[model samples]
Target: MNPVPDLVPARMVSEFVYCKRSFYLEWVLGQFQENHEVAEGTALHRKVNAVKGSVPATSEEKPFKATSVQLSSPELGLVAKLDVLEGDGSFSIPIEFKRGAPQLGDDPVWLKDKVQVLIQALLLREAGHKCSTAYVWYDKVKRRVSVPITKEAIDWALAQVADLKKVAASHKIPKPLIDSPKCRRCSLVEMCIPDETNALDGKSAQPPRRMVATDPASRALYITTQGTYIGLSNGVVELREDRVTQEKVRLLDVSEINLYGRIEVSSTLIGACLERNIPILWFSSGGWFKGYASGAMSGNVDLRRRQVLASITGALDYAKTMIAGKIANCRTLLRRNAKIDVEPTLTELTRALARVKRCKDKQSLLGVEGIAAKAYFSAFDAMLKAEMGFTLEGRNKRPPTDPVNAMLSFLYAALAKEMTVSLLSVGFDPYQGLLHEPRFNRAALALDMMEEFRPLVVDSTVVKLVNTGVATPDKFQYRGDGCIMKPGMKKDLLRAYERRLDETIIHPVFKYRTEYRRALRLQCRLLAGVMMEDIAKYVAFTTR
Candidate 1:
């Protein structure tokens, strides 16, 4: 059980009154994602956050005003950082700054804002100053609304604090609001997933609105050249080798960094990436995923606890769902792309998918998956144009024997790495999985998530590369019977893989279009929703 915080911030109390689930996500789970509104609010607070003056300790002091005053009250179990505090040697007023205009009603100030200021007033009174009223400064309209701090208002604020404490101690996330207008512009809307959660939980019958962006503003930065040095300078990432700069990219434009083989990165850049919550993935030159370095682990302990328990008790159920989705997707891909006759293979895969539901345990599930995979891979070569000179003699890995197999192996590893990053971002333990058994140094959960995406992402990319003549016979070199992609070919493959990720497709369930990259995170979040019991079941993404 989690312990309740000793002192609740006045801001959080306001947040609780506005939306309980949002407060729980931000305060309890430590989940926060900044959007344009939040960024603008931060910018607006810049001058006010710079502490300028102090609140008078005694009533005998002369009149003074303070900006950015920190005060806490143990007796009231409250803390606040006032944007502005004014005292005239006898009475004090706490002023809170807001980015937007005041509420449109008889009371210009919102109840949440009023409660926050009242709490701040109580904190000031606890500091031995006479406080009776507070003010809310709305910067958007340059307006100030006065809120009288009455005994009744004090009681209401305290009551809210008490209720918040109970909710915190309970460790049960509050249900998201249904179809609220407040969700449209909320910075945490994507994380909270209010509409999607409510729809999945059967609380709402409407389809969820498209809250997330079609394409991310920032993208992954891949470093593949041998002996490349990555350093930070003036908010830019500079790739230097042999003391000469090869490339430069602004830090703000990079969402994550992927380093392959013998690359060196400066500690400063790594620290900056950590501060920004950007993951750095490590891979071998042959596209083998090694590991990753990240900052603090996710704070969603309850979800992970549930995941561990489910992995122990209910692994087979999840395995069936994911494997069934995988087989269905594989059949769809073969049906849509295969040039040759693949009716028999498609029928066999459909039968395998049906067998998935009747599997008794993990072993049976694996057997079903293997059968489906064999049937799917049997017709995989027919998906590509025969004139491209690429043929796959069934899927082979760990030193793929043929060029097509090598490319497929590399792209699959990249997809697995992408899933790992997505799972980590959604606060899942990547090593624990349902379909794939956890092994030492293996991201089994990522592998499990990769099942449904392999045919849609990696295999599709391989097909496009082969049919478009981007990958040719000369692009591969054989080393002791192991086919490996040459340097130029590896770069080409990465480009094609990223392009596939950027492609937008309509989600089968949501009836909305989103990029494959964003869909990865969305699927992980949906899985989390199921684990958290906000949703009835996990719905695997299967492209039509």
Candidate 2:
């Protein structure tokens, strides 16, 4: 039996025309960012295309009009949904509605927009319609720009369709354009890191991070409650508590399984998870990172090699930027949420930001970070609502003396796991460090990457959990020297952490809204870009 040929979406051709790297990121990696421009365009199309009752929109000059027509060409392996067709059955022209203003003659910026309609016309022609010309209506200008459907345009689009099919089969990402003006308006810029990847010197920079599909349907299973037993059953993983099945999910649906202390997992299940490339992370009862059981190394070896080399060569710049991000985020968080005046802390953070840029060595960078952390955390006590009974005397990690410190430590550990997973997904050696000291059997690179997120993720999460009464003193048990969280409390914190990761925020560089989880991956990819010298500067995720 002959295998079915792969079909290429007509819109992807437009993407390839816009930027080959963007096309790869979208079509291959399944990554996307939503921004105001994208939203505006979507809304505009929806409004224009939602014309009811098939009452064809006809202009005084043209007597025919049809909206939202689906056309496909099986021989070409292409499918398209034409926005508007404005001719008779045999002879028709495609009218594409764009949200942008009309551009003058031979503007390269509108080339992709023109190619989009040309592809639609090609598909229409293959469907037994004669399309000689296509029109693009600009919403801002209220003018329809006519593009002739020439032999050359048809041949170019057909070749691109073939190229797109090849790309689909090969699964190789295209190189990004360096400092392209078109990148400023591209929605995928944050994820693509065009500037960073394009800036890499082929000799010094490492290979760019490989693009991996992040399944939105996959879920993370948190075994928070104690006495829970995990086992394999009929290609599905079952969770039981007190001999009662609490949940059962097919192994395919699970991406990662995290278990707190006292949770038991059968060896069979562990092996099954590892075989399926699902990582299993273990946390202490008090939410401390113990270790993780994951599948064998699956990423590119050269990427790891480059990560080690780049960490040493770019240590100073990486260290400085990460610390600056941490301090800036700390100041922003204090100014926005702190009940008391944060003028002093903000001033100190400002000076620290300035000093961080001038740091020539890792030692100076660490010193600046230490000073910023001191100033930032000193004001932490004032930010908490007095009713919560959570106070932070200082940032204490080992055997946290206060409930706040315990939560912070636990949250930081959780963030570490997230960063490590993200780095691994992008084929980085999580043990190599630029900002943090590398230790035996430690993911120091994850620690280094998490520096920027400490204030943005952990600190903010703890503050919300306490101030909003989501987590109270009763949720934490006071031990001889430290505080511990019960399984139930861990469950609550897990819920909050997952929610925080799922929360969407606007990325400052791309001006696009992305989930915190995907943002972590973006940061990792950007770091890879920097290591490869694809970009000039590494921009961190800083909150307003």
Candidate 3:
């Protein structure tokens, strides 16, 4: 006997008919991003979504109009919360509110809309109400189109429901649409990356179209004060110190909350952040990442499962690609910024990159990476101005001996935290790594991904801070044998780091310009695509 299918929302059936890939991403993977159109549609449905009135069971009851009328059909394995249900005792009409205008031709309703309303009608019928017709209200044109609920339409809708269940159960993401007009208006276009996937797979000859904006509108909120308390007040986040309000920000404006040192957060505020899908990152006073609190793990179980398998099977090619990108970027940074002749160091890095490609196992890859890192950092002090009174003996951490290493270590910690968040957002097991060995409480996958970005983001930021005199030797203090940044210096470094993340660069592979922050998430999504076998191979981000 076949397994019983899980009940799906009627809206999902409509989505499946519209775009199978989209349905899979949303229904199966639990991914969603709101665009302007979606936002507008949400605004239009505010009243319709509110539950009011009720659907009567008997013809003897008086006529009534219900908003947000929920109905279900067990035998059909379907459920729907209809926008509006207009009913007399004997008959009922289901109405759906759409944000866009109706179709241009004789069949004025879109197939997806028709199927959606028809399914709602089917649910009403299952609930013992006679629903012969449905109405679609196009808020854009302020017109209502009537749809006849017929046997053929009901059969087609049921078939789509069955197909959608099969697709969901298959755990395979459908191939994206090729240059379809539907992509232009889709909110998930950025997540789907249709053209990019096709281009990487060699199915498309053209470069991927930049269909969606890459930069995030929301920004991370950093709370660094030692005794700050965070609380929620009427949709605003309030930061208080000593029972006095220090700052208030609208919750919608914050994407992530980064807390450093001794900070208190109210349970209400935490709940609000979780509801909005904003992660709260905890850090020690010295800028070491502790952990993060998020609402729930990403629902992309298939991707995470594949990640675990790949980790055990030894993803040698992925390891080589990441390390090669790291070595290449390190060489580029040295060549671009080194004030002294470092031709030998450059040659050694090139050799290391060559060795990375030839390595047969993770042990050899680690050896090559160590050699490349030593060669790169051997001449690291040459990149800084001598007048800045800063020098690097080599990369030192876990109590960096010098101001340069201290700053580098701090910035590296920040970069690792960023990678951790990126990996979590893409539904990967941040603790499972292809190159880095897993340790208790260590995000090895984040460490693996941050290798390529260390020189490009953190190291570059450190050099800029030193050479520009934004960070001075006076900003650091010696505690025991370890050097640490003063509180003021820590603030300045964070500001510079955020600015660097906001800086835009052209992607060497996609040939599109995007901010580093978005690029991080984009790279994570691409990595997930590789794990899911949607893309031909993993391509690490490399700068020119």
Candidate 4:
């Protein structure tokens, strides 16, 4: 059996929404491992929570207590966690912590929020307090948005709970009636057939794209003296006495440039792509890559591109300060959360200062030199599980170990693949990194950068899977005294991990909660400008 995570079903939903496979393997299988993203997220949250005296999100130790508490409704069979409960002056207020900004107009708030308030109201009433309205605190707004638990909301909550019970009892997962635009990030896409994809009157951007069966390796592109070419085979190209760049066959476009082979592709032609931000991922034989991009002009978007450029320069200039500010804030949060004086690692702080000085040139922390991360990861050994599966007796590096480590290694492989996707979107080389040591299987820089997002994205999600029995120990197998995942494990793991990425968490930087999955992509875009030598500064992600 796996250890239970310290969270309610809602938390699990939030986690699974980020990535389904992560949730399944961690929550169900009792398998655990940590990557840079998980570690970074964990450290940040620990720092955030450690500030307890008053919940002044900025203050490390001072937290203002939420006025009211809510207990699960025994009579109604419902569960909820309220953030703050206000007392119409006489008593404390009831409030709830939400991951995103509010979308209030005229129509009533969402059913989810209403149900949450209704439960809080019921709990307060049971506690001998009269409550009518509740506050919905958005982390993005950093203020309380008022919401009343009306008769309608209460009635809906009761009915939904009953329906939820029935749904849970059903062995098979139910497909979403309408696909939430957010479902693209849902880990359950493979399992749940949400109508949202086909329910819409027309094609929408929200539905998840089904996997394509084409082999990426089979598709190829190149430039030669003959012209530009795209194909699925190496034998198609015809070479003469000289190099391919010497001959112009048929294709025509912008300026041509040389590449891996004697052939060349037109850079000017590719430049015409509209609002281009898609990243390119180049996997190397040794886990490193050479990347290229064209999205560095985000801020300078306008007619003439000059007006936009002028303003963007100013914004990029400010981004450097933002980076400095973020590091300082992270330091402070750490002090408050862990109750330890995490003095700056850089005594001279040369690397940090250098990054800010050349903000537009450096896209991320991984690009910042002189900082070592492996030691920091070693400090977090207790929080991570040994990779399971595979065996080589007493020797670890020479061969393998328990099934868990093998699983973790596999998980890392997937992360590497995803990192390539993220880098391409922002137009960077996923392989050339600042923090990681170059090696055969190393995506060092990407690995270094991912450390910050791991806790909320992976570890916590895994805990949910195990605690809920979504993955059980029995699902694994041992052969030759080596533990390894059973045949069906990878698919199951992917299902849960996808959901976890889809889960929403209040974005620490944007102040609006977005899918953990989407956030990863967005972060890559911001780094692009820094790489293109365009931005005046780069800002590291931090609590907004």
* Per-model TM against the reference: 0.98, 0.65, 0.96, 0.33
Between candidates 1 and 4, the one scoring higher on TM-score is 1
Give the Å shift of residue 395 in candidate 4: 14
Ranking by TM-score: 1, 3, 2, 4
The count of backbone overlaps in candidate 2 is 7
* Shift in Å, residue 360, candidate 1: 1.4
Clashes counted in candidate 4 amount to 106
TM-score of 2: 0.65
Candidate 1 TM-score to native = 0.98
Order of candidate numbers by lDDT, starting with the best: 3, 1, 2, 4
Better by lDDT, candidate 2 or 1: 1
lDDT per residue (tens digit) for residues 362-404 in model 3 = 9999999999999999999989999999999888888898998
Worst 10 residues of 1 by lDDT: 208-217
For model 4, residues 1-544, the per-residue Cα lDDT tens digits are: 2233332343333334344433442333222334333444455344334322222222122224643233554554444544443333343346666545677677434545555665667666655565667776655566776766677866665565444444333322232334454444443332222332232223333533442111122211222222233221222222233333333322222111212223333343344322233222332211123444444532211111332343334444434443454344333333333322334442323346565566454345334422323322222222223332112222121112453344444444445555555544333444554434445645544564454444444434443454455556667666664555554564455456667766877665434456666666555544533332323234555542
Model-by-model lDDT, in order?
A: 0.88, 0.77, 0.88, 0.42
Model 2, residue 219: distance off in Å is 2.1
For residue 166, model 3's alpha carbon misses the true position, in angstroms, by: 2.0
What digit string (tens of lDDT, one per residue) describes model 1 on residues 40-76? 8899889789989766685557999889999997777
Q: What is the alpha-carbon RMSD of candidate 4 to the true structure?
A: 25.9
Clashing pairs in 1: none
